[model samples]
Target chain A: MTIPVIAQLDELRSTVAAWRADGQRIALVPTMGALHQGHLDLVRRAGELAERVVVSVFVNPTQFAPTEDFGRYPRDLERDYAALSGTAVSALYAPTAQDMYGPNFSTKISLEGPALGLESITRPHFFAGVALVVTKLFNRCAPDVALFGEKDYQQLKVISRMTKDLDLPVEIIGVPTTREADGLALSSRNVYLSEEERAVAPRLHMALQDLAQVVSRGDPIAAAVAQAREALAAAGFDVDYVEVRDAETLEAVEAHDRPLRVLAAAKLGTTRLIDNIAVPRA
Target chain B: MTIPVIAQLDELRSTVAAWRADGQRIALVPTMGALHQGHLDLVRRAGELAERVVVSVFVNPTQFAPTEDFGRYPRDLERDYAALSGTAVSALYAPTAQDMYGPNFSTKISLEGPALGLESITRPHFFAGVALVVTKLFNRCAPDVALFGEKDYQQLKVISRMTKDLDLPVEIIGVPTTREADGLALSSRNVYLSEEERAVAPRLHMALQDLAQVVSRGDPIAAAVAQAREALAAAGFDVDYVEVRDAETLEAVEAHDRPLRVLAAAKLGTTRLIDNIAVPRA
Candidate 1:
């Protein structure tokens, strides 16, 4: 069945309102266009949770730094629609930049706890932008449940915290990270990688997996993380950060008694790749 | 009729949901619990606009600076309830601080534009706190319209902008400031005034009125504002800021052709007072 596409806010609301009037539960999956199997997986999960599903494809400008890939971030709406066809997604909310952020728009949502370190150090404005856009999406769709890929683990945690803090009525659900057969976490940015960089991209996940095993074996966290960074750098990746921290709080873990996660971000050529894995306790 | 005071979020939501289910529109008037005539005026206006009215009285801690009046801020729930007894308010949402802000709360809503100057210079965290609490109130109540007093003109603008920017599905209505017989804007903080300070408090509003008249007569804005500040200082008050700005944007008005607002904040002995009046443009 051909899925309906909603580009304007009024139309989106009317459609969602009709569904709501019929007592149909609505779920939303927000993404930046270049859709892949991972995004489709999120849509499928949203379908399981709600009777109606909406997917928002917006490459939010605020999340991208001036030097980062705002202009080059992959955008293919026609391909995205084609990819989403026959999926559980009933409508696509593809707002223009102006539609999302009109002139004189100047509000920002900032979060601390889980949004403190990791990606924020390099991209300080990233989560604020994500928070702002996600907030708009939630308000626009008024969804019963919102789905996010756990691939952006920190983002999932940040959105969960934001929803709870703001007392938003929507339930936030995190879907497990979908990965390539080669163990590379699927991301829209993965398309930016050259053939050689693509071959090397899976190493980030592999290094995180190795670090998780070492932490599970009761190795000193600092030493294990440092070793993982060195290995990634040796594999031609410009390592950004490699650390083991509390899975929920994202705070540095001093003891291995609590649930810990091994997280890493590295630049394989021009594309920055991030991945995380849970550490099994001894 | 006596307003039912709801202390729990679940109860508040159930009540609001029941109203919504009956096809009745809801209006919310968010306040801090030292209810004055101005707050009741907001409730009255809220009643005029919707079938049901909810007034949330939460003394949000995040909006207050450590050096500011959080500790000494007045809290008299019984007096507040007594004051609202005969008003049009249907329910009073009085959530405990812990209920509004849980242990892991780490989200903040910030705004630029209208939130840039005036009050923000002294109370930096003020608008963020207001935005956060108001967002929660809107979500919790699911109101069709939310009323705010124009006594805090900048705040009204900030919230209006935030509602637009965040795409919140609620109308923000700014009610005109309710004033004392002597023209002092009614505020909960007025209880902090001593007899001598109370006598001097009306001068803040008087000076703003004078400045508005001066600006209307085609007087240079900077000169008119400077003279108002001098008058406030000579009136035995510690002046914080007295300036003329664009009524909507809160930006300094370069020309008298646009809608102008004369805003002033001054400290009368230990009590802080703020007031604003619309300038008649030439």
Candidate 2:
């Protein structure tokens, strides 16, 4: 069955309220509208958790810096709707920029912990934008559960921390990253890559996995990360960051007595790619 | 009837959910638990708006700086409970600091617009702290409406802006400021004033009133505000600030073509007093 599309806030609220009155549990999957297999998987996982599912597709301009890809970011609403036609999504909430952020809008959610380091250094305002959008989504949907892909590992942890700290009633669930056969994590920005850049993108993930293996072998974290950075640079990538940090807190780790994650962000030409792998303690 | 006091989050949720099942709309009145007539007025107004009312008495520590009075803030839950006995309050949610903010708390709500000038200049982190606690309260209570006293005029505007910006489902209502016959705004901190300080506290309100009258007589806003500061200082008050601003946006106002508010903050002995009055357009 085709999913009903809701653009207005009042319409979305009425539909969700009716579903709620019928005693159906609701789940939310927030996206940026250029749906890939990764977002589809999140929708399917949301369906498994709740009787009703909502997929919100807003590009969220606040999350993008002026130098970032806010203007060039992919947007295909018709294509996204077609992709979700066969899915269990009950409604698609695709609010306009004006709808999401009104003229007088002026609130931001600042976060620490998982939001520190890595992406924040280059994109200082990124997580604050993400936090604010996710908060609006939660308040609008009032869902029982929300699903996020672990492809953006830091984002998953940041949202989890926000939901807990704010005592939001919804439960946050992170699904494993969906990857291509070549092992590249699926992202909407993948469309920004040229053919040659796309070929080098998979190496971003490959380098993180190599770093995780090195950490698992009890190599010193700083030395291992430097090695991985050199490897990526040699492979024609402008490495942004490659570090090993605590999996939960995202703080830099000295020794792997606790759970650790090897995360990396690199640019192949103009398109940036990020990926992470879990490093089991030795 | 005596109000049932609930401190645990789980108990409060279950009670509110039961009320929801019975089709009762809920209202929340958040306070610091000193239980003055001002807070009681909010509870009474909440009772008029919804079928059930909850007063959350948490002295949010984040709102206070190290130099401020978080440690010496009054704490008399027993007295607070006694005060609400005959009111329309259905439940008192008096959670401890640990209950309201866990160890992993890392989220903060930063606002612009209404949170820009006035109180923010002196108390830089004040509105962020207020936004965070109010967000937690809204999530925890899930009320249909929330009431706030307008004695903290900037706070009322900030909360209203946050609710609209974040799309929080709760309707934020501003209760009129409850004042003493001598015109001192009722506040939990009012008890900290010495008898001598209390006697001089009424001058803050009187000065703002004088400023408003001058503005009404077509006097330039800057000169009127300057005159009010001199008057407050001459009355033996350590003037912190006396300014005229746009009532809604809290931005500095040069003309009274729009609604203007004359707000003043001054120190009398060891206590600080704040007051404001509307400036009638000439």
Candidate 3:
């Protein structure tokens, strides 16, 4: 049964808390509500893991840069509802921007990291906004386990770091990145790509796949990364960053840490997509 | 028999949780472990509120500024144990800095307010540190209610703000500032003062009390604040700031909107002290 979307804070708590007391274990999938395969994957996983799944579909305005695609970002509820019609998602908390951000809502948690190097440089305050809003969502939803897609690899890593470091009693589970048969990483931003740019976007995945193959073959660190950089350039993609870091810590590989992730972000036309794969253990 | 000083996290949890489960309501009073009468008042208040009380004696290095007296701060376990010996306190946790701050400690929460504006001018990262460490303590202690002293009025307000904003499941009870008979606010820092400085230390309280009196007489806010500043100067105390702010919001008030707090901070030689009063509702 689709519980109606709750917009107000007080109503949301009372409504959810009532459900909680009735022995329903909640699973929350926090998203910005441009529902795609990536979002559905999260919803389906939450459905699998919990008795009642709640998907908070509010597009947090603070997470967007003034110059980023906050206002212009595509949003359609009827279409999204159509997508998750038969899924385990019990309700959608599609609150307005005003309801989520109160007049006195100013304080935010900020995280600095080795994973946040170049990605942070381009989108300063991006992770801070992401961390804070996710934190608020955790407080509101009170889920036992949260499901996230590794497509936004750093974000999943950041959530894990924040959860453990703060001693918040929630388990973070990362599902593999969903991708098109042709290999473009599944993203809500893919809507912005034109036909030609969309055609070339799969080069991102191919480059990352090549890097994973090299690292698996026990190639020297610098050489494997360089080969992937060359492939991205040859594929006509505007590369944002590519780093091979320890999967758990997100710390840059100093002397060949096992279970590394070869991560990449590249722009095709107006859209940016990221992809990552684990470097197999020796 | 006195409760043992628990250093292990797991040991402390079972000891406290068992007491709580037996229908003994629990209260926590967190301290930095020098254990003065001010801290004892908080423990005493906790005892009054609940059947079981836990006193956490962690100096909280995260709350201390890097250049501040984190290393030099007083710590006396033998004396602290002797002090809490005869109290109704059920448990004492004295986790080390390394235990609290493990291998990749990163997440920090910031509390918002003009309450933050109090000491933020001199110590920029102070409230962020305070908010982060207190949140950590709450997670570990998991008390039904926590006791704090309003002597560090801004710190108490910030902790309460974070608790409410985050929907943390703990009641915050602010006890009135405990002071010496001579009116000097009791603090571990009082040990740093020479006898001459200690003699004038009570002037900080006198100045705040004078402002409280002026506001009571219906004087203009600016005039009452100015008179308090003059009082501090006449007592040879180096005045840091004197102002009126909303009792709840901590926002500046030129005119009374709600009950206001007349607050002052000053230095007598090397000792810095702060005091505040809830101005009678106008």
Candidate 4:
């Protein structure tokens, strides 16, 4: 059965209120439509954690710079609905931009910690937009738990940090990144890749794996990063960054005294791809 | 009986959860704890709106600048407890600074519209600090509705705008400012007034009254504001600002096509006081 799509803010609240009245726990999976296997996996995991699950599909314009793909970001509500039809998802909250942000909307949420570098360096306004919209979703949905895919590792950390810092009473659970058989992480934006670019996309994940392995063996961090960047460049990718950092804080790591993460962001033709892997403690 | 003062985040959440489970609607009255009749009035109004009302007495340091009175801000928990003893207040959420903002608290909420000028022009860090801490309190308390006194008229407008802009679930209700018989707006900072300063303070409110009267009767706004400023200065106060603004947006008004407010801030000796009056339509 297809899940009900609530477009009105009042309707969403009433639906949540009704579910809450019945003592049902709720989980939220926030997305920007154009569903993929990864999003489906989030909905499924949301069901495991909650009796009622709400999936929000809002292509937040603020998260995208004017030069970025705000206009080109694929949005298919019907396809998203079809993707989650068989899942235990309770509702699909798809508020229009006007409903989400009305006239004279002048409030913004900015962060300084985990949202500092990574995607922010390339897309300066990215995390602030993410933080504001995610906060709005958390407030509107009033969920007990919210699921975010680890495919966007930096975003997951930023949201977790914002949730804790703001005292938002919701548990942020990061699901393991879903991947295709070829190992490229499943993403809605993956469709932007041309046929040739799609074939070469798996190399980003491969580079992260290689970087993680070398860092785990106590190899020089700079050398591991250089190798990843070189491999991406050889594969016709324009590398943005490849580095090893403390997993929790996303700060630069030299000794790996704590858990470490190897992250990479690079562009395959016009499509940007990012991937990360945990560096095992030596 | 005195209300329970919850200082821990988890305890506050559990308290809210228990109230929710009991099907109780909650209201919040946030203050800085030198509780006067104005704050008590907010708590009383909060009870009228919801079955349970949580009063948060936090002297939030973030809202004060280094040069401001953060270190000496009035905080009397025992006195505050006594003040709310016979009131309908359910819980007192007085989380410590360390609990409210942890070691790595890096998130901030900033506004552009209502928080642009007036008090913000003088205390640039003030509203941002208030915005962040209030957002945190709203998240932790999860109140169904929150009340703020109009004594801090700009702050009430700012919080109202923020709640709408951010889609925060709580409804913001503005309570009328409570005043002494002599008509000085009740404030925690009023405690800083000396005997001579206290006698002269009522003139600020009188100036706002006079400004509103002239503007309401079709006097030129600039002329009316100048008169109010001169009157404040003549009354031995250092005038900060005296102007008419759109009540809803807090923007300067050329024509009184909408509701208008006349506001003034002046310092008598070391004590800075602010007051506003509504301009009745002609």
Candidate 5:
């Protein structure tokens, strides 16, 4: 578990190529350097999938809005390096802000799918930033596969599409959400919630669960969405959106042919949390 | 002098890797099919620069507009192979349209450059197509350096900017133009010209030469552009554009701080011709 820290771009390329030459399969775990348990699970899965795992800790500024928490975002690399010391990661590509973005940088990619709608509502240009940085990391790491957690369900779908669309020579292996003993999904933003805010956060999960049950009972797409909206309102959520859309197209479900997501975002006090549950059928 | 023809993308990757394993530096000469003397010059130069040269011939469709001749594009593999029979090109990657654009492929790149204005005037979506296909070829080949010709001046500049901006892991090398006996720039589209059209085509080059002579006298930028336009009109050309602008920024020049281009496009009857010359600062 000797995780080498790489800063320079060319040096990272040669090091990864050396790993490939040794016949060791490589996996990438991309992160924003706020190594909560949710992100740690992805690194663990990367270890399980390949002989060598690379944990990329880049807090991509392009992915955050000007009004967003890009400046105040937490970064404690020494603590993160220690948490992964006993795990499967072989390197930590902890590049600085300048290392990733220089003066000549100007390419901006427009991302599609769930991220577009979600980010558009709260943080404009958020998905473009995510798309640009993720593509950058993909080019940099050249990983055999990349591990992404389902906690960021929309993000996983968007990244999977980006990798496939661009013919990036890496597979995106999605890991399931890591959660507390309570039903709340584990996330770095969870730290910002107050005691009362934290207790009621599970209501998001409960609302999703209620919608999933209604969907299984053969309610139409509109009904399932309606039920979920009511549940969130009853729980005192400042509801952002509750959408029922085709899992594949990320568009409104015209006819219920495939998987659907009952997705929601809400603000409890000052913390904003998002979650989703796949409706197996509707 | 065995010019290896690699069909699959993976085979090209592995073969390049094997050559690198044996300590051979590789240079890539990427081209759209219909190889003329200009493309051959690129291949020859690649052979000179590195121990191994990989020439890729794919008529990338993404860069072609709906009205352009994509399906009807000429491909003379037998002729091309014969032309390079004695050259030291270690391999030739001539993939089918199927291999390059997979069945479900649907990603397109938009290159935001100063030449984007020309795209709207000439062949909207042309630069986007150029950027996407060229970037794809760069990723697939992963060469020590890639070669482009100065004939397509805007394209060379765009790709150079793209490589720098993206931090792509390859060096870009530019080769001077290879001209026909009549001093006409050799292009695949030259075949489309009628005998009379072909006779008048060299006048496009003549007009640029006259403009360069005027610019050499340190005439004001607008005055030199006006002179180029008059020369094109005198040569019986229906001019599309004739302007002098800074090379890198593509902005209209006030003074010569850098290289400037006297660029022109015209239609001699049904056949369109374009040419440019670098203005020598007096």
Candidate 6:
């Protein structure tokens, strides 16, 4: 059976309101909707956490810069609905851009701290866009809990920080990143990669794993990241950044005294791939 | 019959959750609490709208600049509780500054549209602070409806714009300004006036009223505002602004083509007072 799609705000509210009135717990999984296995797993986890799950499939325009691929971003709603069929998911909230953001809509949620560096350095407008849309989803859906993939580690952290600071009643849970057997972090944009780029993709994760091992055995973080960047460049990728920072705060760390996360982003042709792994205690 | 004061977030949430479980509709009245007749009226109206009413008395530090009156902002909880005693208000959420905004708190909700010009011109940091704190309050209390005094006219419009733009589930209701016989809008800062300054305070309101009258009778908005500014300056107010704007958008208006508002802000001694009135459409 196909899951129901709610397109209007009032309809979505009434639906959630009815479920809430029945004393059912609601969980939300906000997605830009090119549902892959990773997203499916998030839905499964959401079902386990709550009685009903709302999967929001909005391709938020504000998060994408004009030069970015927002225009070509993959959208296949029928395919998505087919993928979610028979799953524990209850509804798909796919509000059109016009419906989601009316003509005069002008509020924005911005953050500091964890949102300051990393992805922000490349896409300064990205997290603000994510924060705004996620906030709107949270308010509209009124979920008891919301789930996100840790594949976009910084995005997860940013959302977590904003939710807590705003005192939003919902709990934000980050599910572990799902990856291909060869270890490429699953991403919607992966479809954009050519066969040659796809063949070279798994090296991004491999380099991080190798870097994590050396750092775990007490290699200096800076030098380890430098090596990772060089290795990715040698593998025919354009490296954006390779840096180790405090895992929790995402603040700059010169040494590995505390729990740390080594994050890296690189481009294989036009597709940017970002991945991070915890540095084992040295 | 002293009303209960809930200072901790956990306490506030549990109380609200219990009320929701009972299927009781909730309303909120957010105040900085030197509870004047204006705030009491908001609480009274909130009770008329919803079954249970929560009055949040947070003197949010972020809304005040260092040069402003944050330190001197009147806070008397016992008196506030005493004032709420006979009203329909159920609880006072007067969380401490530390509890409301922790050491690492770093998220803000800012806006354009209605939040531009007007109060934002003199108190540039003010509305951003108001937006953040109110968003936090709305999420924490999880109200079905929230009430504000129209005395802070620009603030009422700004909050209305934000609540709609962000898709916050709570309905924002504006209560008419509680006023003195001479038309001075009641505010917590009204107590800051000395005997002589008190005599000059109502001129701010009278000036807006006069401006509104002329603009409704076909005077050009610019000429009327300029005359109001001169009248206010002559009456011992170091004038901040006297302008006519679109009532809904708070955007500048030159002609009487739409619903108009006459707004003015001026300082009598150290007390900054602001007031507005409709332009009584031609």
DockQ numbers for every candidate?
Answer: 0.91, 0.91, 0.54, 0.88, 0.37, 0.87
Q: Report per-prediction Cα RMSD to one decimal.
A: 1.5, 1.5, 2.8, 1.2, 2.8, 1.1
Candidate 5 chain A: worst-modelled 10 consecutive residues by lDDT? A104-113
TM-score, candidate 3, chain B alone: 0.95
TM-score of chain B of 6: 0.98
Over 4 Å off, model 3: A8-25, B11-25, B47-52, B85-88, B218-223
Instruction: Give the DockQ-based CAPRI class for model 4.
Output: high
After superposition, the stretches of candidate 5 with alpha carbons farther than 4 Å from their true spots are A1-3, A111-124, A246-251, A254-256, B1-7, B103-106
Better of 5 and 6 by TM-score: 6
What tens digits encode model 1's per-residue C-alpha lDDT throughout B25-120? 999999988888889889989889999988888899989999889998889988888988878889989999999999978998989999998999
Better of 4 and 5 by lDDT: 4
Instruction: Give the alpha-carbon lDDT of every model.
Output: 0.91, 0.91, 0.80, 0.91, 0.78, 0.91
Tens digit of per-residue lDDT, candidate 4, span A198-252: 9999999998888898889988889889988999999999999998888998988
Write down the TM-score of every candidate.
0.97, 0.97, 0.91, 0.98, 0.91, 0.98
List candidate 1 segments past 4 Å from native: none
Residues A1-282 of candidate 2 have per-residue lDDT tens digits of 767899898999999999999999999999988999999999999999999999999999988999998887888899999999989899999999998898878899999989998999999999999999999999998999999999999999999999999988999999999999999999988988899888888888888888888899998888888989999999999988998988998988898799998899998888899998899667
Which of the two, 2 or 5, has more TM-score?
Answer: 2
Which 10-residue window of candidate 3 chain A scores lowest in summed lDDT? A112-121
Clashing pairs in 5: none
Q: By summed lDDT, which 10 consecutive residues of candidate 6 chain A come out lowest?
A: A214-223
Q: Could you give candidate 3's per-residue lDDT for residues B165-219 as a string of tens digits?
A: 6666789999998899989888998998898888888888877887887786677
The TM-score, computed over Cα atoms with residue i paired to residue i, of candidate 5 is: 0.91
